[model samples]
Every structure is written in structure tokens, then in C-alpha cells.
Target chain A: MNFWFAVFRQAGRNLRQTWTSQLMTFLTVSLSVLIFAFFYLIYTNMIGAGDRLSDDLRLIVYLEDDPGPEMQEQLRRKINNFDKTESIQFISKFKAYERFAEQLGEDSDVLTDMPKDFLPASIEVVPLKSLRGYNQIKLFSEYLATLPGSEKVQYGQEWVERFYYFTRLITIVVLLSGALLILTATFMVAYTIRLTIMGRHEELELLKLVGATNNYIRTPFLLEGIIQGFMGSILGLSALYVLFQWISLHFAGPGLLNLFNFTFFPPMVIVSILLGSIGLCTIGSFTSIQKFLKI
Target chain B: MPKLVHNQDPIEPKDIPGNTMIEMIKVSRTYAPDIKALSDISFTVDTGELFFLIGRSGAGKTTLLKLICNMDTPSNGLIEVAGYNIHNLKGKKLAHLRQKIGVAYQDFKLLSDRTVAENIAISMEVSYKKPRAIKQRVRDLLEQLQLTDKHDALTGDLSRGEQQRITLARSVANSPRLILVDEPTGNLDAATTERVMDLLTRCNKAGATIVIATHDSSIYKDGNHRVMELRSGKIHSLSRNNR
Candidate 1:
């Protein structure tokens, strides 16, 4: 206990002696961590939005023209019995024409000039939350096409699959980039601390001559590094939080929120930041001391 | 007791009783591959003995001290301090051996950032002395070295004489069994040198072995301590006076 007290006292003395150096270290660490946090937040928000979009995805099943009520009922039963089906809505040929007319607006004469039976009735099939993506939706559509009186089945599987794939690729890229940035920051901090230790080589030699063991001599400097890292982390976290709030307030539209949502920073993210800061500090201090304590 | 004469040869280990404090036999140290600092030197210091090593500046006085303190290893041969072979000691054992020996450098290597009391307290702290005991010991040493008034002053603020005295106090704070001083009075006035030597003699009386390296001949002229003069790299002569 007394040993640790002495170590802290010495660390305090070092901080006072090199306040400018400490401040510089703090700024460097803080800026790096802030950048990491920003990228992490973006990645997290993108994943969340992607998941929501995937969950709400719907499969549209177009149908053959003018099936009798009995055939339509049978089709509905088949879809309801399908394992992946959540719900299905039927649209008759007349309703499809009406929707086309609504889209044509005051130019409804353009649709009226077309053949009356050209439009096809369709069932809009919504899959269960668990059954998503192109493969499952394609299988369901194939089953629908084999049903009696059904000539065609169509859904937006191509675009939905492409969207999912693109988002997944983006998430992977973000994760890889974040990991690389973290590694680079760690190495940079370690090198900085090593340089600081080298600058004080003469003082260290004097301490060694006076009978200081490696631990006794190193504990204070290591503590200083840890304190610097922690302070930097706190500063970075606060700055990130303020920036996130400002962006959220200034850009409240769904298009912007869909890209950069601040609400995605869960409790786990805060824990991760804490652990990351400590790990960086530990690596920096340990590496620096390894070189400095060669004697 | 009768005083030994000048130029008398040191007693061989085979002829003497076993009460030696330090013994180096054929110790050779080569810093670089080509630069031999100490070449096959052999000597012993008995318990509570005051021994002086007089030599030129580059005659390896500091290297000898480092060897005895286990800070460096011999290139060849054996060195035993307080019956422990120093060549084989490492890590914790080396630290233990170092704690038993007090060392003072010519530059008065005091920690400039700490106060005089704190500087002296380091020795006691390393030895795991209790805080209260360390405080009292610091006080006692400051008074003994006539540095009581400068106890709380920063070491950098003190004069060279005062800083040297603080270094001495730090060296002796743990009551080490041996004191290795390299040019303890090199930068001091004649009066300060006498005072430092007197303090060292007092420590010798209290059963601490003293090994000093100096170019100052005046100290050996009036003292009864054994003096080993180094001409080139090897011992030129070993003598004792009856002052």
C-alpha cells in the first residue's frame, strides 16, 4: 500500500513536471478514439436500419386473370398454409385497373384506352419475420405459380436481395476499417509513450543507480500513461456525444436519420469504449516500459 | 594495536583467517571488445576496513565500484561480496546485494526534483523502513551532516557542498555494510573535503567498510587507512601508514 502511495506521488510529480507533454498525449489519444467512436456509431446505425428494412420487407405475388371465387379461396388457403407466410391480400383485375387509373390521375383516358383485361390481379404476400430474403421468397413464389388457375408470380426479390447484400458488405467494411483504425491508434500511442520514456533516459538511469527495482521505477510512469489515456478517452467520449446530439438535432429527417442515427449507441458501446481505452493505455505503457527497462 | 607500514603486501587468502568482506580474484572486465577496463585484478577488503584506491581519471575506478555493486559482471574470474559470489547473483539477489552497499557518485547524483529529506529517505524507503522511522532517520542524518537547515530545500537549490552532503546522508541512511564513494570530495573545498572525510571515518568507526577512489593525495597523507595506488591499469603499490 505504501509502495503504491509512493508510486502515485511520483506520478503526480511527473504530471506537474511535464504538463505540456501530458496535454499533448491526451489530445492525440482523444482525437483518435473520437474518430473510432464516430465510425462505430455509423456502422451500428446502418446495421439497425438495415435490420428494420429487412423485417418489413414484403413479397408481391401477381396472379392469373379473373379466377372464380372458389379458386381464389383455394389460393388464399394455400398461401395461409405455407410455412413462411404471415398474411396475404387479394387484388382483383378490376382493383388493379382502378389502381392504375388512380396513378394516371387526370390522364385516366390513357388506361381506359388500354384493353380491359390486360391488367392482372395479384396477392401481396408478407413473409414471417423469420422467413426473409430472395431464396425463401422465390421458393414461395414458385409454389404459388404451380397452384391451379395461377399463370404468373412476381416479387421484388432482386432489389431486396441486392439491398441486403450491399448493406452486409458495407457493415463488414465498416467493421474492418474500425479494427484497422484501432490497431493503428494503439501502435501510435505505444510509440509516443516509448519516445517519452526515451527522453527521460538519464533520469531513469539515476533511479536505477539509487537501487530502484524495475517495478518501483516503472510504476509511476505507467500510472502517468494510464491517467493520460483515461482523461483523453473521457474527453473524446464527451465530444462525440455532443457532436451526435448536434447532428441529430440539425438533421431530423428520415433520410438523414436512416444514415446516421445517434440512438444506436447502446450501453454495450459505452462499455466497449471504456475497455478499449484501458487496453490502449495498457499496451502503450507496457511496450514503453519494455524498452525503457532494458537495464 | 600496531599500525602496518607503507608498501606492505596485502595478505593472501590462504594465509589469512576467514573474515573478508569483499574479495575479487583475477577479475577482468572489457567494456567493448577492444577496451579492457579492468584486467585480471585481485584484491580483498576485510570487515570494517577503510581502503583507498588512488588512480588517474581513466584508471577504471568507477568500473571497479560497479563490479563490487553487482551492476556489471566480470569478463573473467570471481567477485564475492559479504560471502555471496557477485558474478552469479542476478535480479532479486543482485538487488539484495546492492542494498547492502551504499554508493555516492562524484556528481552528487541526488534527485534534483525531490527535497533533501526526500532524497535521503529514498535509501530507507528501498530498505522497507517504516515511514515514521524513515522520517526520524532523515532528521538524524540531516543533523549529523550539519544539513538540518536545508532538509526541506530542493536538492537543486542547494550548493554543491550541501548537495554532496545530502548524497552522503542518502548513501548511509540504510546503515549499509559497505560504502563505495567515487571522488567524494572532487568538487568540494578543502574544509568540506575534511568534513566529508571525517564523516566517512565516523561511519567506518561504526563498522561500515569504506572503499574510496580519489586523486586527492592530501587525504592519504594524514590518515592511517590503506592506500592502493594505480599507475596505469594495474595496482602499482599497496601501502598502510601509521599516522
Candidate 2:
């Protein structure tokens, strides 16, 4: 339609006429999106590592003393009978001492100086595969503590609870920060586009005098905002991808990177970012048009 | 020639009856506190008539035109144009109302950045006219206004008279029902002024209710059309040629 053509024509003209200011808006949106994406990647990898840790959950129930074989069998039966217990393993005191010696490699003198039964025997309980969440594992640990002949129930103690708490805090912080970044991007785009509109104030008054409706006047601005938003997001995402690749290549080791599973965002997350950028820009332009045009 | 309706006696806007194109009853426009542009002004112009508003600078001629076209709202009273109350019109209704009216401002408010043809086409383009149709319309206006050579010239590059002609061409591109022109000959030579007046007469003959605001004596000396002179913000006198 001619109406749409005019809108495009006007939008294109404005883009060219105010490229300097528009580029500032584009860069601001890009930087904001990049910051948020970086936060997202960090948070996602932390959560992923925490999830892997939870999946490999092992609850070690140290015994009061070396229980007899029959008593060990009874304890195993009692733990397995419980609702969420998947499987259990019994380690003899000698086997525990051997494992401890393996952990203290190059320090065989410490083991020789200690007594023969220095290590305590233990039963390791694996909860139901479905019980990987923090609360579920804690409840299972509490159930294990009730059994007789058990010294202490250690579900990786300090780290598991702390990691779960950290995951929750990171999630909340990332979400709030991402939202604030988006808000800042929206206002920046609005302010930048407002300058562009002010530059064309004379033309706008002429358009109004010649009988342009509010929709007709606003269409071009909306289109401009959408295009700017889409471009900025693409730039941000591209920058993020390059940075991730650089870090991955530079730190090509088997320690933290492999443990935390750090990588570029998934395709689905990228798509969401693109869509969100467009929406933010559109909202910014709409705000500017509503305030400046006032029609 | 278009009909020039002469008022034999004083007639208020509220008292004017039958097929009126514009009616303003006690319209007052005040800016801020105690600065009044127009006070209790009332007038009526019938359809298909050529009328002139004679006044000095800052005599509220431009403000009155703005009020009739709904570009600016009247502070106090009623303005009815094309059978719709101007105060109640908004959005689509206001736009539609404005579409039927054309204004050539005293300062010739042409988009200087655009070409002369573009300036003319914009008037028709806003109404969603086809590109081909707009091109033809612009061409015809260019020829009619004797600005065919300046069609591609930037409006800002042209002389004031040329810019005024482009403004006129743009204003009448839609063949509006009402044409409100303010000081159309402000920057024209005597020869150009006659040509401009002739072009307006041609549009008036095509059935546009024309209102011209001018301090030029040549336009009102003949007293052919009804002339209303504003001395401050009130109508100083209203008269027409007796012949």
C-alpha cells in the first residue's frame, strides 16, 4: 500500500538523516544485550555444573565401628527398604584405609605412622535417580541418619547445600539484572529516537497540517525502532559468540571449563534474545512517538 | 467567476444560516495568562464564496485559520466546519476534516528539504493517493503554477515567490472544499502577484470556498469580495463592492 511505502520511505530517510545518533542507540543496545548475555552464560553454566554434581550425589554414612557382616546386611536392607533409596554399597575398614592411602599420594609416611584401623568403615547410599534436587537429597539424608549404627550422614556436606543456595541466588540476581539492562536499553533507544524526531519537527508539523493521522505518522518510527533493535541484537550476539570462542580456545584445558560446561548460548536462547531486542526497540520508539507526537 | 457573497448588514456567526462552509461563534484564543490572541470573534463564510480577511500583522488572521482547520483549538467558543463540531473532532475525524481544507500560510510553510514536486506530492500522498496518480497531480500543479522548470529544485533553493507558489500548489493539490490563504502575495512582485491571484481565482471558480488574509491594498481596493478588516483582534469593518 502507498501508506506503507510512505512509512518505509520516511523511516529510511530518518535513518540516513540521523545515522550518528541512531548509531549511538545501536551501540548502547548492543552493549547492554552483550552484558546480559554474558550474565546468562555464566549463570547457565553454574547451574549446569550444580546439576551434574547433584546427579552424582553420594551420601556416605560412616559406621560407629566395624559392624559384623550380618549387621551390615541388615543395615543395607533397612536403607534399601526406605522410599527413595536406590542402592547402597558397604566398604570394610581395610578398604576405606586403602582408599584414603590412595587419596594421600606421595605421602605414604602419614599412613604408616597412623594406627591400623585409622579409617572408619562406611555405607554409601545412592538416592532415587529422581531425587537430585537439594531438598529431596536433604530429606533422604535425614532418613538415613535415623538408622542404627550410623556415625554421621555426609551428603558432601558444606558444598552441596552451598552450591544449591548459590545457584538460587545467581538465578535471582541474573534475572533482576537482565531486566534492568533491558529497561536501560529501552530508555536509551527512546531518548535517541526522540532526538531524531525533534530534528524533523518542522516536517512533522507540516505532515499534521496536511492531514496525516497518528498511525500514519507513527508507522515510520515503529519500523525504524524494530530495525535498529534487530541489528543491535545481532551485533551483540556476534560479539558474544566471538568472545566465548576466544575464551574456549585460549583456556583449552580439562579443569574448570570442562567441569562447568561453558559454551555459547543455545540456538533457542539466541532466538529469544533476538526477539527481545526487537520488542525493546519497538517499545522505545513507541514511547518516543507517544510523547513527541501527542496526536 | 465564483460567487462573492456580500453582507449588506452586520451578521454574527450564530445568526448566519443556510449551507455555511465555516461558522465561528464568539471564539476566543488566549495564550497563558492574560495574553489574548483573538477575543469573542464571530464570522461565517458560505460555500463557494471568495472572502478576504484584511488585517495588519499579528491581527489574529493566522490564528483564526488555524482554529477553523482544528490545528489549534479555540479557547472559548464553537467552530463548525463541514457540518462537524470542531471541538469534538479528534483522531480520524479531525484528520478527515482537515483533508477537506487547505491552508497557504503567511510564511509559506513548505518543507524546504524536499523537492518542489515532492512538496506538492506529499499533500496527495498523505491521503493515500496512488504513486502514479500523485505524480500526475504534481505534474499538473507544476504546469498550472508555471513552476515546471523548478519541479526538481529543492524548495529551499528557490526564491521566496517560488516557494510561495509551491506552497499554493501543495495546498490545493487535493482540490479541497475550503482554501484558507494568508498573505499569498507577501513576497511576490506585481507581475507575480497577479499571476498568483489568477491561480487562486481559478481554484475558487472550481468551487473552493476561498478566504484570503492580506494587508495588500490591491486585493481589497476593488472590494469585489466581502472584506473583513481586523484592527487589533476585532473586526474593524465588513463591506463589499456595491457595483
Candidate 3:
């Protein structure tokens, strides 16, 4: 316990003695972590948005003609046989026109001159969450087309494909930023420790001369690196949270952009990033101090 | 006693077998590019003896100290200190060996950023417990060395003589079994040199085996300690064995 206390005190002294360089390292690591977390935050929220949208996924099967009540019942049975559905409602041409009018609101008069039966009747099928994949919906659409009076099935395939690519791009960016963060933190920390070691070269030799073990000399520097990593990550996360709050209130709130419900990283991800940065810094310190402690 | 590292799972000192604090047989150290630092050197120091190595600056006095401290490896032959092969000791064992030993370097290798007390306290801090005890020990050594007022002064800010005294204080702070001194009176005036030597002599009388390396001839010329003269890395003569 005494030894550990001394090690910690030495580490604190090291940090204070080289505050200039240490500060630079801290800021650099913080910036790297912020960039990585920013991308990750967006990626996670995008995934959440995608999941919520997918759960409300609807496959509208347009009918060739208004099917009799018995045919509608049979079609419902067939759809159930293929896969369960949250709801399967049949909408007549009149109902479709009324719904379109309701959507248009002030422009409802524009559609009054159009014939009532101009719009086709359709069966709107809301699939269960488990059956919401693009391929599953596509297969279900194909099967729906074989129905007795079905004209075509539409599930906005092009839109889903586009969203998928956009999310993939976000994921790739997050990964690249994460890799850059690790490298930056590792090198910055290594450089800081190397400078400290060189500055205290004589002191280290003296310590060794007075019977200090390798562990005795290395512990302080190791602790210094760890503290840097821990503090830098926390600072970065705090800055990100501040920025998140600003954006959340000024942009994503109700009556604002309403584009996304932006959220900060979950507890697990935050813990992971903190642990990863610390581990990276330790490796950096470990590698850099090896040559100096050769004696 | 300091108990050196004082680890719970310590590798017990392997059957020391005798009171021989240091033993060397044909210990030769050859630097790179075929430069011989020490050649076929053999000697021994008993448990409570004060030994001196007198030589010129390039006579491998510092190199000898490094070898005994396990800071360097011998190119050939055997070297043992405190019963363990100095060359074979690695990792914790080597550190443990170093803990039981102390070296007062010729260069006054003090941490420039640390205070005088911090510098001296380090030796004991590594192997001792209780902050109050470590602090008291540092105070006692500082008083003996007449550095009581400089406890909080940075070592680099002090004069060369003061720094050298701090080095000596640190070496003996941990109460090591074997203390190696290089040029103990190098930067001292006559009065300071006498005081430094008296402290070392007192430590030796307290059961510490001491090996002092110096290039000074006048100081040890009439001392009653065993002295070995090193010329060009080989023992030239031995005299004053009236221990």
C-alpha cells in the first residue's frame, strides 16, 4: 500500500512537471474520441430510426377488382398461412379516395371532379416485426401478386434499399473514426511518456541505483498514462454530451427538424470506449518505456 | 533490517551459506568492439568490511559498480553479491538484490525536480512502510549529513557538494547491507570530506559492508581500510588490510 501510494504520487508529479506536453496530449486524445463518438451516436440513432420505421412496415396489395367478401376472407387465410400479420384490412375504391382526400386536407376539392372508382381498391397488410426484412417483404409481395384479384404489391423497395445504403455508409464512417481514435491515442500517449522518461533519465538511473525494481520505476509512468486516457475520454464524452444537448434542444425537439430522436451513447458503449482508450494508452506507455528502462 | 523488497511471496534468499557479502572469480567485462573494461578480476568482501577501490577516472571503477548492482552483465566469469549470482538475477530477483544494496554514484544522479527529502525518501519508500517512519528516517539522515535545512530544496538547485552529500544520504537511507560509493569526496572541501568519511565509517561499524571507489590517493593513503589499486581495469596492488 505504501508502494502504491508512492507510485501514485510520482505519477501525479510527472503529470504536473510536464503539464504543457501533457495538456496537448490530453486535448488531442479528447478530439479523437469526440470524432469517434459523434459518428457512433449518429449511427446508433439511425439504426433505431430504421427499426422503428420497419416495425410499422406496410405491404399494400392493390386489387385488380373489388373482390367479393368470401374472396377477401380466403385471401386473409392465405396471407395468414404464409406469415402472421398484425392487421389485414381491405380498403374499397371509395375508402381510398376518402383517405387521400383526408391526407390532402385543404386540397380535397381538387379530387372531387375525379371519378370515385378511379383509384383502385387495395388490401393493406401490416407484417409482424419479425417479418419486416426487405427480402421477406419482397418474397411476401411476390406471393401476394398470385392472389385471385391482386394487381400488384408495393412495399417501397427503392426507399428501403436507399436507407440501407445510407446506414451502411454511417457504419463505415463510425468504424474508420474508431480506428483513427485508437491510433491517435496510442501514439500521443507514447510520445508523452517518452518525453517524460527522457527528461527524468538521471532520476530514473538514481532510482535504480538506490534499489528500485523495474516495477517501481515503471508504475508511475503507467499510472500517468492511464490517468491521461481516463480523463481525456471523460472530457470528450462530456463535450459530446453538451453538444448533443444543444442540438437536441435547438434542432431535434418537437416543432423543430423532428428528423431524429438523437440520443447519447448507452451505458455499455460509453464503458467500452473508456476501457478501450485506457488499454490503448497502457500499451503505448509500455512500449515506449521499454528502451529507457533497459538498465 | 530493511528486508529489501519485503514482498509477501518473496523468493527467499537461497541458502546464503556464509557471511561472504560479495564474491567475484575471474569476472571479466568486455565492451562492444573488443574494449575490455574489466579482465579476470577476482576479489571478496566480508559481511562487515569497508573496502576501497583506488584508480584513475577511466580505470573501470564505475563499470565495476554497475556490474555488482546488476545494471550490466559480465562478458565472462562469475560474480556473486549477497549469495545470488549477480549475472543470473533478473526481474524481481535482480530488483530485490538492488534493494539490499545501494550505490552512491560519481555523477550525483539525483532527480532534479524532486526535493531533497523526496530524493532520499525514495530508497526507503520502495522497501519500507509507514509514512511517519520513512519521514523520520529521511530527517535523521539529512541531519547527519547536515542537510536538514535543504529537505525541501530541489536537488538541481543545490551546489555540487550538496548534491553529492544528498546522494550519500539516499544510499544509506534504506539501511542496505552493501553500499557502493564512487568518489564520495569528489566535490567536497576538506571539512566536508572528513564528515562524509566519518558517516560512512559509522555505517560500516553498524554491520554494513561498504565498497568505496575513488580516484583520490591522498584521502585513503593513511586510512585503516583495505584498499585495492586499479590500473587499466586490472588490480595493480593491494594494501592496508588492517581491518
Top-scoring candidate (lDDT): 3
lDDT of each: 0.75, 0.82, 0.84
TM value for model 2: 0.85
DockQ of the candidate models in sequence: 0.15, 0.29, 0.49
Q: Candidate 2 or 3, higher DockQ?
A: 3
Q: Top DockQ: which candidate number?
A: 3
Error of 3 at B91 (Å): 2.1
Q: What is the TM-score of chain A in candidate 2?
A: 0.85
For candidate 1, give fnat to 2 decimals.
Answer: 0.16
lDDT of 1 at B147: 82
In CAPRI terms, where does candidate 2 land?
A: acceptable
Residue-level lDDT of model 1, residues B1-243, one tens digit each, is: 111111221222232347788898998888775788888788889988999999999888888888888768888889888777866765445555566688987777787877999888887665556789999989988887778899899999998878888888888887887899888887788887887888899899998889999998887777687888766567777889679
Q: How many angstroms is residue B5 displaced in model 1 relative to the true structure, after the best TM-score fit?
A: 48
Better TM-score candidate (1, 2): 2
User: What lDDT score goes with residue B199 in model 1?
Assistant: 82
Instruction: Please state the CAPRI-style docking class of candidate 3.
Output: medium
Q: Candidate 3: lDDT of B170?
A: 86
Model 2: pairs clashing at backbone N, Cα or C within 3 Å: none
Report the C-alpha lDDT of model 2 over A108-190, residue by residue, as the tens digit.
66889787687888898888777678887787788788889788899887898888888888888789768966897798889
